[model samples]
Target chain A: MKAKVIVKLKEGVLDPQGQAIQQLLAQRGYSQIADVRVGKLVEFELENVTPIEGEAMLAEIADKLLANPIIESYRIESQ
Target chain B: MSIAVITFPGSNCDRDCLHVLQNVIGAPARFVFHKETDLGDCTGVLVPGGFSYGDYLRAGALAKISPIMPAIHRFADAGGPVLGICNGFQILCEVGLLPGALMLNRNLRFISRWVDLRVENSDTLFTRHLWQDQIVRMPIAHAEGNFTVEPETIAKIVAKQQIVFKYAGPVREDSPDGNPNGSTLSIAGIVNEAGNVMGMMPHPDRASEAILGSTDGIPIFRAFAEAAQEKSRLEYSY
Candidate 1:
């Protein structure tokens, strides 16, 4: 089974890299872009687990490893 | 006094820290690998910088979960001083030894240069020898040295005098030339509530020698050595 974790900076935290991308795109004439919040996506394969167990285990792993509770949040999805 | 510099897999500045502590400061300094569960006879620990775990997951995330962290945490809990520099600072905050988090520079650039810092509170064990508001030059080389915390936490830190250093230049907070990473209130370094742990972005070890362009960093190492020696003496005497 495969899993994907989407890690995002928690709201209210400044996303400098995301802001830079927004500025760069605006300068390149992509005027409609309102904002960009940069984040990370991690993918991995789990061994011999059903989707239900994978979901539960991934949630725990995300809280403990994939995301820092202080600055980031994570969403785990089956891929 | 004996100090240990904890070396993670990618810690590039461990040797610089050891050199300063052992050769420049005249304290016995040694390395403690990340996998070691014991800090040995070390009275103080220095978390030096590099791309620990290649800055994967987060700048210091992987290193925070290393086997050595629990030992360091216990050491700090027992009132042992722990100094974290650059990536080490990130790890300290990640592990909750210190409050706040370091974010990417607002300009999204890897900053590597010297900047003047104003000593905020000189009453702590780390800065007791330095006078408050004194300006010191230190080199900061980091991409994620921008510090942030909740407004409430910031207020409490200020009230409790946990802030130790700030940028010193015209319009300190707004001037990129001063606040190199756009840190909150120009904060460059801070101590924990217990005053036993400190996390700072500047590389003091890099600036400890005159040949490296400044001796401003020497006072920091000296202060740590002095504190460690005093603590050890007190323990042995009792």
Candidate 2:
């Protein structure tokens, strides 16, 4: 089975890379976009686990290693 | 009598740390590989800067879980002075030993330069030799040194006087050159609540000698050595 973790910076944390991308788009006449936030998607595979177990395991992984609770949050999904 | 400088893979400044601690500061020092479980009989632990684990996932993220970290934690828990410099600073935060996270610079550039750091708190073992508000020049080389913490945590940091160093001079006003990275409150360094573990973004080892353009970093090493000596004497005498 495959699992995914989407890690994103917390709401109040500043995202300079995202802001720069927003500016670059504006310069190219894409002005309608209000804001942009950048994040990461980590995909991995796990075996011998039920879907429910996979979800729980992914959550544990996300909490312990995939995401830094101080600045980033993560959501896990299984496939 | 000896300080242990842990070297993770890709750590470029470990040698420099050892050189400064052992030769320049005239204190016994040794290098301990990151994979080692023991810290030996070293009184102080120094985590030098570099792109540990290739800066994967995040700066200092992977190195935080290295095998030797638990031993370092145990040392710090026992009041051993642990100094983390640059990437080491990030690792301390990554491992949850220190508060906040080091984010990318506001301009998103890898900055390398000598900047003025105002000593914020001189009461700790790390800053005891320096007077509060004394400005010192230290070289900073990092792309992600912007320190950020929530407002509540920042309050505690301020109330406890944990801030050890801050970028001197005006940041928002006319002269914005002092703060190379957009660290919250221009924080360049901070100490833990117990004041034994310290994490700073600047590379003090790189500035330990006058040939390196500044000797301001010597006081930090000197203070640590003094405290380590005191701790050693207490442990062995009793």
Candidate 3:
């Protein structure tokens, strides 16, 4: 099994890199874009853990290390 | 009464911090590798600036899981002095030893230059010999040094006088209100609730010498040494 974790800055947190990218897009005639945000994705390889266990483990890993609760939020997907 | 300078793999300023603590400040200091289990006999811990763990995942994120972190947490829980500079600041925050998290600069550029900082609170272990609101010059070198926190946390830290240093430079387009990294309320350094653990983005170790362009950071190092001596004294007397 493989799991994916998406870590993104919270809504109110400033994302300067995203803004820079958005500006470039607008310059290239993508001006209709409303907003842009940056985030990280981490893939994990699981051994024998069931879906329930994998979800719990990934949440803990994302909460404790992968994503900072103060400024970032994380989502987990497993298959 | 020595300060333990914890060196991570990518830590570039470990030598500079050790030099300031051991040679310039004349305080006993030793190097403790990242793998060290215990902090040994050192009274205080110094987390110097550098690209620890290559700033992967985020600045200071990877280094938070280092083996030495548990020992650091124990020392901090006991109210021992822990100072984190630049990358150190990020690591401390990642470990929840500090209040806020550092994000990319507002302009998204790495800022490296001398910045004027007003000593917001002189009563912290890291600012003992400094005066409140006294402007001091120090070099700041980091991109993810912009400090951010929830709205509620800011009030709590301000009420506790946790803000130690605030950039006092003139307002610039890149750094609104003169904060080089656009930190909230222009904060450059802060202390934890216990006031024993401190984290600052500026590199005081780089500014502790006159020949290096400033001596304003010398007193700050002296304050840290003084705090270490006090900690050692308390241990021996009891």
Top candidate on TM-score is 3
Q: All candidates' lDDT scores?
A: 0.88, 0.88, 0.90
Measured against the true two-chain complex, the DockQ scores of the candidates, in the order shown, are 0.62, 0.75, 0.92
Docking quality category of candidate 3 according to DockQ thresholds: high
Of candidates 3 and 2, the better by TM-score: 3
Predicted candidate 3 versus true structure: per-residue lDDT over B97-206, tens digit per residue: 99999999887889988899999999888897898889999999999988999999999999999999999996667666788887999999999998989999998999
Please give, for residues A1-79, the per-residue lDDT of candidate 1 as tens digits.
9989999999998898888889999999998999999899989799989999999998987886778887888888796
lDDT of 2 by residue, B107-181 (tens): 899988778899999999999999989999888899999999999999999999999999885454433766778
Which prediction has more favorable lDDT, 1 or 3? 3
Q: Which scores better on DockQ, 1 or 2?
A: 2
* Residue B138 alpha-carbon offset, candidate 1, angstroms: 0.9
By lDDT rank, best first, the candidates go 3, 2, 1
Candidate 1 lDDT over residue span B1-238, tens digit each: 5788999999999999999998999988899999999887788889998989999878898887899988998888888888999999999998899999888887778988888889999998888878889998888899999998988899999999999999776444446467778899989999999999999998889888889999998889999988777777235311
Off by over 4 Å in 2: B169-177, B233-238
Ranking by DockQ: 3, 2, 1
Best by lDDT: 3
Worst 10 residues of 3 chain B by lDDT: B229-238
